[model samples]
Target: MDSSDATPAASAPRDPAAPTALRDEADAVLRGLAGETARLREDQWRAVEALVAEHRRVLVVQRTGWGKSAVYFVATALLRARGAGPTVIVSPLLALMRNQIDSAARAGIRARTINSANIDDWDSIQAEVADGLVDVLLVSPERLNNPDFRDTVLPKLAATCGLLVVDEAHCVSDWGHDFRPDYRRLRTLLGDLPGGVPVLATTATANARVTADVAEQLGTGAENTDALVLRGSLDRESLTLGVLQLPDAAHRLAWLDAHLDELPGSGIIYTLTVAAAEEVTAYLRSRGHTVASYSGRTDDAERQAAEADLLANRVKALVATSALGMGFDKGDLGFVVHLGAPQSPIAYYQQIGRAGRAVERADVLLLPGREDEAIWRYFASLGFPPEDQVRRTLDVLASADRPLSTAALEPRVDLRRNRLELMLKVLDVDGAARRVRGGWTATGQPWRYDTERYARVAQARAHEQQAMRDYVATAGCRLEFLRRQLDDEQAVPCGRCDGCAGPRYDAAVDPGALDAARAALGRPGVEVEPRRMWPTGMTEAGVQLKGRIPADEQASTGRALGRLSDIGWGNRLRPVLAADAGDAPVTDDVFNAVVQVLASWGWERRPAGVVTMASRTHGLLIDSLGARLSEVGRLPFLGRIEYAPGAEPAPARSNSAQRLRALAGAFTVPPGLAAAVAAVDGPILLVDDRVDSGWTVTVAARLLRRAGAAEVLPLVLAVEA
Candidate 1:
C-alpha cells in the first residue's frame, strides 16, 4: 500500500535546489516497488534523504497505507548501496514482518526474519546478517529479550547496523493504545549503537503524547540529537465511517447477517474476543456466508491459510480479533466492521483504517453492543499488578539459587502465567531483573514502583474509554472524531461519514435474519473438560500433588450452559455472576437452559446423585441448584462438601499450582455425605455457581471419589474462558 494519492508524495517533487541525485535514486526505488509509474511522495523522499544523507533519528506518523514501509525499504536500498550494514527492523507482529518482507522483495531488497516460529532458521539468518548478504532483518519486539540473541547477536548488530527501524512505534509508549513492555528495551540497544547510526520509528495510531515518548526514545543514541518527527493528517479520504448501535448481541449478529455482503467487497469482521469471533463466524457461515475465524487461539498454519484466503478474496470475510490489526497489508480491502466497539478511539481508528487503503470508496462500520463494557472490564482487569505483587515476584527471583522459568515462578507468585510473564518483561526492562539462559534472575538493582506514573496511565486509559463512548454517541463526523483523538491538527468534518452525510446503513434487520440470529445465539451448552494434570512445581508451593491426576479420582468431562465470554448466554450470566450481585436461586430462565443441556448431554451412565460444592459467595444458589436437580431427576440429595475450618477460599484468577495449593486440603466430606456416597450406585453431580480455575471442582471431585462414588460429573452455570 504505497502513499501514491492524497499524501506528501503527491504534494510536490523534492526541492530542485537540494541534491537531485538522491531524489532520482529514491524515485527509481519507488518505481520498482509499485511499477514504472511509481514515484516517491515528497515526505517519502525527505525521510530517505534524512537517513541516507543526514543520518538522523526520525519518526513518521501517518495513517495506514501512507507508505511507511516504502520509506524504510527505500532507505535500506540506498544505505546498502553506500556500504552500510543490514537495517534491523524491530516489528511488533509476524504478519507485519511477512508483509514487509514481501514489500522489500518488490524493491529488490533482501529481507529475513527471526521469531519464535522459525527457530531452525536463526543460525543461518544471523550468519547472513554477519556476511552482509541480507539488506534487512526483521525481528519481533519480544526477540530483544531472548537470552541468546540479546547476549550475542544483538551487541554485534548494534555496533554495525546502518539503520534501526521501530515499526508500530506506539507500542513504545505506555500512553499508546497498545503498549508492549518489550518495546521499551529498544532504549538499551539505541544507547549501544555506534555513532551516526540513524534510527526510524513509525506508527499510525500514536497521539501527541505517544509521539513525543517514541521520539524521545529514538534519540537516545550516543549523539543524543532530537529526532525529526513528521506527523501528518490521519484522515483517510476513501473511508465512510459510521456507528450502528444495536440493541443486543443477537441484533448485531443479525445486522451483519443482513448487510455483510452488501457493503463493498471482501473484507474483515472484527470481534473483541476469540469466542465472539468464532461465534460470529459460525453464525455467518450458517447463513451461507463464506468466512473464517482468526484469533490468537488459531494455530499458525491455519492463520496463514486464512490470511492467504482473505488476500486472494476467496472468502467474503475473516471474522477476527485484534490479532489481525497491525501490519496486515491488503491494499484493496473494501470494508472493516467491528462486532463491538474497542475501548479506545485510537485503537478503533487503527482498525477501521485497514479499509479503503487503495480503493476510491470503502465502508467502515461499528455494530456496538451492550456487552462491550463487560468485555472491556475483563481486559482492564489484567493491568499491572499491585506493588506488593511486584515486590513478591522480585523477592522470589532474588532468593532463587538458580534462574527460574516463568512456569517455576508461577507457583511462587500469586499472578497468572500470562500476567506474570508481562510483569517479568517489565522488570527486565526496568533493570530490576534479567532474563538469563534458564529463565530470569534478580539483578538486585534498586527499582521504584513509580506510583504516580502508573496512576496517571490508568487515568489515561479511563479517559480513552470515555472518548470511545463519545465517538459512538456523537452526532459529528466519525472520521473527524477519530483524527482529533489522535491529536491531528488537521481534523475536520470529512463530508463522507454517516454523521456528516447522514446514515448510510439501516438499523433495521430482516425479520428472517433476526430470527436465525436469535436461534443461533440461543443455542447453549459448552463442555467443561475436567483437569487431568497438576501444574509443575506444586511441591515447591507446599502441595505434594504432581503428575497426571489419577483417572479414578478425576471428574468426568462436565458441562456448562455457556461461557461467560459467549455473546449468547454471556450477557444473561454476567449480571448474575457479578461480584456485587446478590445470592439467590438460579433463575428459571437459566435452569431451563441447564435442563436442556443435561437432556442433550447423553452421558454414558445416567444414574446420579446431586452434590453441592460450598460457595462462600453464592451458597444459596449452589444449594438450590443441587436440590432442584435432585428433585427433577429423582436422585438422592447428598449433603454438601464443607470447607475445612480456617481454610479461606482460593483467590480468583490464580495460576494452576497456586489454586491447587489453596484447595489441596480445603474441603472435607461430612460423615453423612460419606455414607451417602458409599451407598450411591452411580456418578454424583457436583454443583457450583461458576468455575474459573477449576481446582475447586477438581478437589471436591477427588474427595467425593475417595468417598466411593463411581464417578463425579461437574455442572456449572458459567465457565470463564
Candidate 2:
C-alpha cells in the first residue's frame, strides 16, 4: 500500500509464472478494495485482462453495485506494478472523484484529482504526476475541454498515460439519459492516445444503443477496430422494487415522515429538483430523522461532509438530486426512495441500482408525483437550441476580431449562461469553435450545422421520456420491465416487485403528519438576490449600460410568495404559469398568501405608491394584484409601465441579457405615471406576475427611479428558483 512503488515498464520481459503472479496480485488488490474477504467475479477479471494483459479497449456495461470500480482499481494496481504510466480517469462528478481517491489508496494505487473545487493544490498535483509519484489521476470530463489544460497538459497525459478510464461512459453519447457535451469531447482524447495505451469505458445505465455509441467512440481512430464490450445482466437480485402513487406533495413528505423507520438501515432519498431535495431533507430532520440534503447548490465542503455522514451510517439518508449519483460507493445502502420519477427509465434503474449491492435485500420505492411531468418538461426546455440560434452564435464569433468571454457573448445571444457554455463545448468538440485563453473563437472549419442529427436526438429524448411515464404506470413486474428497458439479456420477472408480489409498502399517511407537512410547505417567501453587475457587452447590444449598475437605479432585495419549484406552492403555480395556460385572475388563496408574505416581510420602509409591469397575456392578473395591494396598504396606484404608443412589441425572450436588451426600449413612463411617480415621497412597490430573470423588474425599477420615485421594491407572485 506504500505510495513509493513504481510501475514496471510496459516492455519488460514476462516470466512463465508472472501471469499467475499478476492474477494473484490482482486478487489481493480486490480484497483490499472490497475489504479483506472479497474476491473478483469472472466478468471483473475479463475486464482487467482486456485492459492490463491484452492491452485492448474495453466497455463494461454492468448493473450498479456490480463492483465496476473494483475492475478499474484492480487493473490500475496490475498495470502500475508492470511499470506502466499512471492511469488517467475521467470522472463526471466530484463525489465520484473523492470516492475513487479513497478506494484507490486501499488498492495501493496513489490517486490525485484536478477539479475546480481544489484549485490551490492543482499545481502541486501536476508536479507530482510529472515526477511519476502518482498512480492514478482522476479528473472531471469538463477539465479535458478546459482551454489551458487542453492546450498544455493533455498532450503529455495522452502520450504517457498507462490507461485511460471513462467512468459513467454513457455520458459520451447524446442518446444517454445524462448526456453531457463535455463527455462527447472524450473522443478527441481517445483518438490522440498513444497506440499501445489501453482504454476502458464503464457505465451502469447504458442500454444496447448507448453501449454501441460509447463502444464505437472508445474504439475511435485506434489500431483496434472493435472495443471488447463485456456486458452483464442488469438484474439486481436484492432489490425489491415498488411504486407508490401519492396524491400530492404534502402526502409524499408525510409518507416519508410516517415510514422512515419501517425501512432498513441508511440509504438515499432522491428528488427531481434541488428545492424538493432541500425541502424533503428539512421535513425529515424536523420529524427527528437523521438526514442531509445533497444538490448542486450544496458547497463542496458541506457536500463532502454529507457524503461522509451517509457512508459512515451516521445519517439515516441523504435527500439528494442526481448530484449524488455516479461512483458514490455504499455497498450496504439499504434503500432508495424517489420523491418523483426520473425523466427516463435508464435513469431510474441506475438510481435504484445504488441500493442492494452488498445486502441480501434493499428497498426501492417510487412515490410518483402528479407534477413530475411538469418538472421533466422544464428540464427538457433547456436542451440544445435550434439551428438558427447556434448559427447566430457562430456568426457572432466568426465576425468578431477577438475571442470573447462567455459573459461578453451572453448579451449578443439569447442563450442562458449554462446552455451557452454547453453549446461552446459541443462546438469545440466538433471543430466549429475553439476555447482559448481569451474565451472562444470560431475555427472557420467549414462546419455544417447538423439539423437532422439534432432533430433525431430530440426525438430520441421524447421517446425516453414517454418510456419513463410508462414505467410508473406499468402493471407488469417492475424489475423485469426496467431490465428490458435497458436491453438486459436476463430480462425476466423477478416475482419480487409490487406488480408481482402485491404492494409491499403501505401508501397511507397519518392524518396528523399530513397536516403538519401541509403547514410547513404552505409557509412561503423566498429572497430574490438583486442583480449587482450588468452583463458584459451591453453596449454592443445597443444598451449603453456597463459595469456595476448605479446604486440608485438598483431595486432593493425582493420577495416572492414562493418558488415555482417548491414542493408546496409549486404544484399550484405550474399549471397557471404553463406556456399554454390562459391567464386567470388571482384566487383568494393566492391573494391571501401574497398579503401574508408582505405582512411577514420586514422591509426598511413601507411603499407609498404601486406600479405594475406591462402584462401582455396577464393584464387582468396583474391589474387585480396591483389594485388589491393599493387598496389594502393605503398606497397611491401608479399607472403600469406600458409599451410606447406605436412601437412594436419585442418578441418574448428566453434569457436575461437578451430580455434586458428588448425591455430597454419596450417600456416607457405613461404621461400621468411620471407625475404620479414624482408625487410619491416614498418607495414604490413594483408588482409583476412572476420574476424569472429579474431583468424586467430591474429595467422597470430603473425607469421609475429615474422619473422621481424615492426607491423601488419588487414583489412577485412567484420566483423561478
Candidate 3:
C-alpha cells in the first residue's frame, strides 16, 4: 500500500546528453499540446520552465488577469509527466475550488473538491488518493480543520502529496492584505504532513510585510525561499481611475443615476453598509437598471441566485458590500464603483481586481467622502484592545490550563463576549495567545507586561487608522498611492486621480449668495428658535440657519413667522440690534407685545435656555427657526444671533387622553390599538413629562368613548385637556 507502488508511470524523457536547443524544442512540444505556450508571456514561460527544471517551489505574485493560474495549470501537466505525486491545492472559497476543478477537467486531469457539501464523497476520494488516481485535490481550510477528516484522510493524502499550492495565500499572514484566523493554523497543518512537501503560495496582492509573513508561515525562511515577488506594471493605459467627491447622500444618488447608463457589461458597486447596498439596489432598479444586491443578510440561496444572474449577464450590475467579491471570477466585468471609499488599499485591490479579468480595459470609480474615513476609523478602534485590557486578558488566560469558553472568560476579564472575541483574535495574531477548542490560551511565553507587544498592537492599529486618514486627506494620485502600498515598483502617476485631474475647489464663493440668504431670513416671515446649537445629530454645518423675529409679536404673527421658518423661507436673518435697543424705533413695545402673546399661549422663554417653549407647538416653532438659522449661520457678521433673556412661562400640561391622541397622530398604530380604543381599556395613566396639546386627552376619550373611563380628568401640575 506504499504511495510509490501505486504512483502513475513516469513519462519517457529525451536524451540527457541532447543539446539545450533540442531540449527546448521538446519542452515546447509538451507546452503546445497543453495550449499554454501561446497564452503565456515570454517572461511567464521562462519562469515556469525554470521552476520545472529546478524542481523548486515557485511563488508568482502577478497582477490580476496576467495568466498567473496558467503557470500552475501548465506546470501540473508537465510535473505529472515527470512522476510528481498529485498536486494538493488549498483554497479558501468553494467557488474557486470548483472553478479550478473544472479547468483541470478541461485539461483532462482529474480534480475534485473535498468540502462541506461533499463530505459523503470523502471515503471514495480518500481511496482515489491512496490508489494514486487523483491528480489534484482542492480543499478549503475548513476541511483541514475538520478533526475527523484530518485525522483519517489527510494523513494518507500527505504521504502521496506533491506541489502543495495555496491560492490567495496572503490569507495565511496577519499582516497580509486579507487575514483569516483559520489561515493562521495552515502552517501547523502543513508542517504536520509527511515528507515535508514543497509549497507554492500565490496572490495578486501582497506587500513586503505580507511576503515576509507568507514566507515564515510556509516555513520557507525569507532569505532561503525561491520567491518571485513580481511587481506588475501599474500602467493600465486602458483603465481610468476616477475619484468623485460627494458632498451629501443626494449628490451621490444623483451621480449614480447619471452614470447608470454609461456602465455596460457586468459591474459592481460596493457600499459600506448593508442598508446602503439594499437602498442603492432598489434605487437603481427603479431607474430601469437590471440590478442584484448582495450583503451579509442575503441568504445562501439568494446569494447563489444573484451570483448566477451576475455571471449570466441577466443583471448588468450588482450592488453589494465587500463580502461579495472574494472568490468571484467574473471575466467580463467592465467597471467597479465604490459607493464609498474602500477600507484599505488591500480591499481596494481585491475589489478592483474583480474587473478586467479577461485583460480587457476597465475602470474603477471611487466616491470619496468623509464618512468613508469615519467607517474605517470606527472599525480599527473596535479591532484594537487597550493595553491594560490586553494585559488582564492574557493574565486570565495564562491562569487557566483548560480552554475556557467566552462566556466563562467574560466574568474573569470583565468584558463582553463580542469585545472579548475581538481582543482575543488580535492577541492571537500578535502571537500573545492561541485559540484552542472553545477558548483561548496563553502561548509558550506569557505576554511581557513591559515589552513591545502592547506597543506593537497599538502601533499596528494606529497605522491602519493613519492609512485611512491619509487616503482621505492626501491630495495626490490615488492610483499611484495604491500601487505603491502594494509594492508595485512600476507605478506611474495616474493622471485621472483627483489630484492629477484638477483642484477640487475651483468655483468661487459669491457674496451675493450670502446677501440673498440674509434677505430671505430677514423678510417679514416666521422664525425658528434655536435649541442647543452644539452637537446636533448627523447634519451638515449649514442646515441650522433660519429667520428669527422678536418674541413680542402677535400670536397670529408669531404663528405665521414659525410657519415661514418651517417651509425654509426665512433662513438668512440676523439680529443686528437687540429687541430692547434704545435707538430702535419699535423698541421694547414690539418685544413686549410678542412676549405677552407667547406667555398667553403657554410658550415661555427662559434667560439661560436657547428658547424654552412651553408646548410642542412652540417647540415646532423653534425647530423651524433653527432650520432658518442654519442658512444665516453661513454669513460672517449675520451668523451671530443672541437670545434675549425672559421669564419662564407656567407649564401647561394635558391629560393622558391628549398625550395618547398626539402619539396616535404622529405614529401609525396597529389594529390592536383601535380595538383597545373601542373597548375603553382604562390603562393607568402615567405622565412623567407635561403634554401641552389636548391630543392625548382626545385620543384617550376616543378610546374610552367606546370603553368605560371612570374619570378622564387631568392629574398633572397643570392641565389643558
Candidate 1 structure quality by residue, lDDT tens digits, 280-332 = 89889989999999999999889889989988999999999999988688989
lDDT of 1 at 120: 94
TM-score-sorted candidate list, best first? 1, 2, 3
Candidate 2 global CA lDDT score = 0.86
- The parts of candidate 1 lying over 4 Å away from their true place are 1-16
lDDT of 2 by residue, 192-261 (tens): 9989888988899988899889877887878866787888778888999999998999999999999998
What C-alpha lDDT values do all the predictions have?
A: 0.89, 0.86, 0.53
Q: What is the TM-score of each candidate against the true structure?
A: 0.97, 0.95, 0.61
For candidate 1, the 10 contiguous residues with the lowest summed lDDT are: 3-12
- Give stretches of model 2 more than 4 Å off: 1-19, 646-653
Candidate 1 TM-score, true structure as reference: 0.97
Q: Taking the tens digit of each residue's C-alpha lDDT, what string does model 3 give over 605-624?
A: 21111111122223333333
* Model 2 C-alpha RMSD to native: 4.3
Error of 2 at 554 (Å): 1.3
Please count the clashing residue pairs in each candidate, in the order shown.
Answer: 2, 4, 30
Best by TM-score: 1
